[model samples]
Target: MKRTTLSERALVLAPHGRDAPIAASMLAESGIDAQVCTGLPHLIEELDAGAAFVVVTEEAIASADLHPLSDWLEDQEEWSDLPFVLLTSRGGGLERNPAARRHLEVLGNVTFLERPFHPTTLISLARSALRGRCRQYEARARLIALRDSENRFRTLFDTMDEGFCVIEFLDGPHGPASDYVHVQANAAYERHAGIPNVVGQRLRDMVPDEADAWVEMYRRVLMTGEPIRFEQELVATRRHLELAAFRVEPAERREVAVIFQDVTARKRAESELRELNETLERRVQDAVAEREAALAQLHEAQKLETLGQLTGGVAHDINNLLTPITGALDLLSRRHADSDPRSARLFEGALQSAERAKILVSRLLGFARRQALETRAIDVSSTLEGMRDLIASSTGSGIELRLVPSPGLPAAQADPNQLELAVLNLCVNARDAMDGGGVLTIAAEQAVVGPGDAGALRPGAYVRISVVDTGAGMDEATLAKAVEPFFSTKGIGKGTGLGLSMVHGLAAQLGGAFMLSSALGDGTRADLYLPVAQAAADPAPVGGNDAIRPVKPLTLLLVDDEDLVRAGTAEMLRDLGHVVHEASGGAQALAKLGPDHKFDAVVTDYMMPQMNGVELAGRIAARDPGLPLLVVTGYAGGNLDVGLPQLAKPFRQADIAAAIERLVHGEKVVRLRPRRDANSAA
Candidate 1:
């Protein structure tokens, strides 16, 4: 919609040539562009291009047929009104002439000047006509802008997805303006509301029952000019409508514009969802109650489990105490009935039962006191290598055993016998963890320890002995208590739970620390830290039972807190052809030793009511520096820290004889000195 401007060209339709030139000159001087035309045909050409005004003579208008000009003027649009300035003679009968009057009527906006008119009068009339033409062009531009705005609005209104309608309030004879007519509607209004041909119709005529409420809503909007939004059901179509109504053209008539949508399905779904939520809440409460009952039952089951563990530990301790009794009885039975050798097999079976029972008892006391340790310097690498066969047999065929000792592993200051037992215990635990077959690795490496490195062990050098198992590992809770006495994760009777505990006790007693680490599925690793020995490891004979040289029988002192064990040991010493002096404890033994008595050796129990064996031996050695001393202990309990020969309880007669003979004959008498440092042996 583009507007056309007033043309600069003013067509002069005068018939005389001189008059046309003069008129052109006058227009040019007046700053108006003019074109002189000879005839009506030429005038038509100029008018076709565009024109501001037309000047014509009375004769030209009277003689000529102005139908072409008439047709051009009649074809003009509403915004166009081309002005014409007619030049007439004085007393000209142009207005009376029928043809001129006809032409004047066709040319709608025209000005006339009589003959002998002043030049200024003609110029002023011509300029006034041009000014009116310019105003017409301005009107045309406004019309075009209005048309474009209407077209854009119409496109937007028709393309909207929501229903839209413009309603004009219609007043009745009395009362309020209660009726509203749909003056305009978009395409979506009929589709969404399910009502067609609703425009140009009164609300009361279309839906008599629903009309009043809707008319009231429209009246409120028109009166107050306030926008409102509400959801309501239309009874005529059974549709739920979400509508927003706002007053439009506030300065003009009362008209309301409505934008609405169909939401019946959404409303139905909301009702169903509310019912479902209520049902779920009840079910959740029921589930919570059931869970509480289950938790109570679980707590009762845990109580029974704890009782079973206590029973197992008690049974194990009883078995340990009975082991020595069973062995002694078996030996006595063999000695009495050796003539009838058939009775020996029955005694042997009894011994086997006792051995089995002992193993069960020992498992329950896994972290209990271990036997006395004879601490010495030993190569950790060689120690592990030597125990390969024993470890393999104990772990069974299901486990693959590997003894991987790192090159240049230093000798560790610990008892070789105790270290071997600790490694075996770890391997056995690893075997049980792997229900299926897996690899058990025993490795040794040299480690340097600075201050605050290994717990409770003085900073220096160390030998790290690691036992790793490719088996089911432990969780954090289980690993935290792995080294606690009798805290087994295995089922009752499956394990004594003393494996890690005993290893931990052994390392600590040997002036080192024990560390265990595991993850749920990543298997377990146990590390035994033993301080590095200052001297090279002694490679001693494996066994020297047959190599003992018989020594002459000598007087010996025997000491024990237990009356029965002391009597039995004294009787054994007398049977071996040695004179024996018996004392109840370290106090009595020290009293018996005086300047008048001569004794070849002193044998005493490590744990007594007062002045135990290690203390007694130290005192005896102080009194008689050359006197040989030996310690016998049932359970050392980490108190055997004296550099003296030790004999573990439940030893055979041959074992006692060998120890006494070695000390009496000057074979291997332990050096007694003002001790450099107390022994770290247990």
Candidate 2:
């Protein structure tokens, strides 16, 4: 009782006799489902309802209206071509009967089966028709599946975020892959590329200027069937894009799929960030350089201050020791002037050597910027002339000396003795530089300084005395520290390293400046600038005091902490025909004073224990304001403001006598001393 489907049943139309019944029986016996149509009207109705095939006799529709049956065949779906098995009388086949052709025209897909033939022939023709109808149904199912897949693909392709397109490479006039056509493109394509309606449009027509690059990129993907990813700029639209391209399957199809997105903003931000980093890098370098310069300056100041303190302390002790030696030697030489010739000569030689030691100590104090300077107006030309022979002897024969003093040059303010020593030191250094042989030129010229010039020099007229030498010179690193105390490049025991430092200190003390310039393998030049003198140079003094003796021998109180120094000074004072009271300290010297023992003057050492010379002077002044006081010191600089007559130590008997005589006579002893601040020059 199951219902039959169109593809599983057959319709029989043979209403003329037992033809319809006989055909239905044959189909039923063959195990095929069949429907018996009563007439042509029933056949049309059964055809509309659907059947796999039809079995009809020729007599039934040969002379009847075949329009409805023909119309049904014409109205069938494209995939439907209903099969028919036609039963014909003798000579009723299409080839034998002319009427059979009309029936064939009505049944589009029909097979002719002649009547009076075996029933096997009818059954075989019905089976063949049903097989053809089954194939048509399978084709219809495939078409429906293909249509549904296309719907889903189109929906996804249109909704994706990234721009997508299918391009078909074309062979153009130029060559293969010379052009490509955009066969398929999605909605995002226009938004990303700024081109609209690109389907079926050639790349050359859309962006002619950039077409070649685009085609070449995609052509490789198509030819090699490989995928590529890259970033590129679309010159036509001025947009930067990140794109990925892959060849479509089946290489011969010559198609590539491209996915891309706009990346212009990101690229611009990266460019800006790169520039900002470069700027910051330069700023950081500049800041570091500035900080290094400041640190170097601070280090130099601290180093100089520390060195000055150390040098001053050492010079003080040495000067104290030298004072006793020099005083004893002077007394011995004078006493032995009429003794054995050999003994007298030995004493004189020792005295001369001690004087040299005193000069060396003075030079050390100068490098420390604590030495007292005797600055005065002096003719540089005359001074150099006087030292010509002496400088020549110091430089030796290998070096040629040249002195070029500018004519009409004004006098410069400086210590003449120190200036001569500075020039001699420079010449000796020049001689050392030239191991083979070279010329050493000393020149003097007038210079005027203005504000904002180098070397921090005060604006004034000055005399520039330069020492130039042709010799192996110093490089920048060495030149920068040439004037620093004890920073020497010479081998040990060859140089003291204080020559240039002494020169620099001397210049500064005299209100001048010193500068040096040199280059490796070129040569060196040292320039000393001294301020112009306010007055003309003083004329040479005639012979006066070769030996200073006090006006008359008087009672003297001599106080010093060093036993040897106090004993030697007491001996000198007694030999000068003065009654002397020797004390080891300020307190001892104060105790010696009483009404029975009167003293004409008190000579005290500035640096001592128990009480210093200044404090002792104050106490003595309270008791006897009219008594003369002389303060002698080994330490020459730094905040020693004693309002009494002062004499630097390491002096001969004549120097001490001169100081005491000046004090006793109330004569002012002018001394050029350094300021209270140790950092400032004298």
Best by TM-score: 2
> What TM-score would candidate 1 get against the native?
0.37
Candidate 1 overall lDDT versus native: 0.71
For residues 195-314, what per-residue lDDT tens digits would candidate 2 score against the true structure?
Answer: 889999988889888788888889988888777778899988888887777776668788887877677766655545445434433443454455455445444543453454446435
Q: How close to the true structure is residue 116 of candidate 1, measured as C-alpha lDDT?
A: 57
**Clashes in model 2: which pairs?**
none
TM-scores for candidates 1 onward, in order: 0.37, 0.53
Count of backbone collisions in candidate 1:
4
Instruction: Write model 1 residue lDDT over 1-682, tens digit each, in one string.
Output: 2323458668887887477888888888889999998898998777777888888876786766778878877778866767777776543245354454555577756655666554555676677667666756665665566556556556767886668898998787535687888999989887778899898998888889888788887788888887777787888888888777777744267888787767776666544544443443344344445545544544433333333333432442243244355546544553654666666666666655655455444333333443346689998777887788888899999998888889977778987666777888998899988888999988888777888664666777788888999999999988898987668888854686657777888888888899888997789999888998889999854421122235578899998766667777776677567899999977789899998789988988776654667667667777888888888765432234566777755554556788787666646666545554334222
| CA displacement after TM-score superposition, residue 79 of candidate 1 (Å) | 99
Name every residue pair that clashes in candidate 1: 89-115, 90-115, 316-361, 373-682
lDDT, each prediction? 0.71, 0.77
Superposed model 2: Cα runs more than 4 Å off: 1-283, 286-302, 338-349, 404-410, 445-462, 474-498, 513-520, 532-536, 539-545, 637-639, 668-682
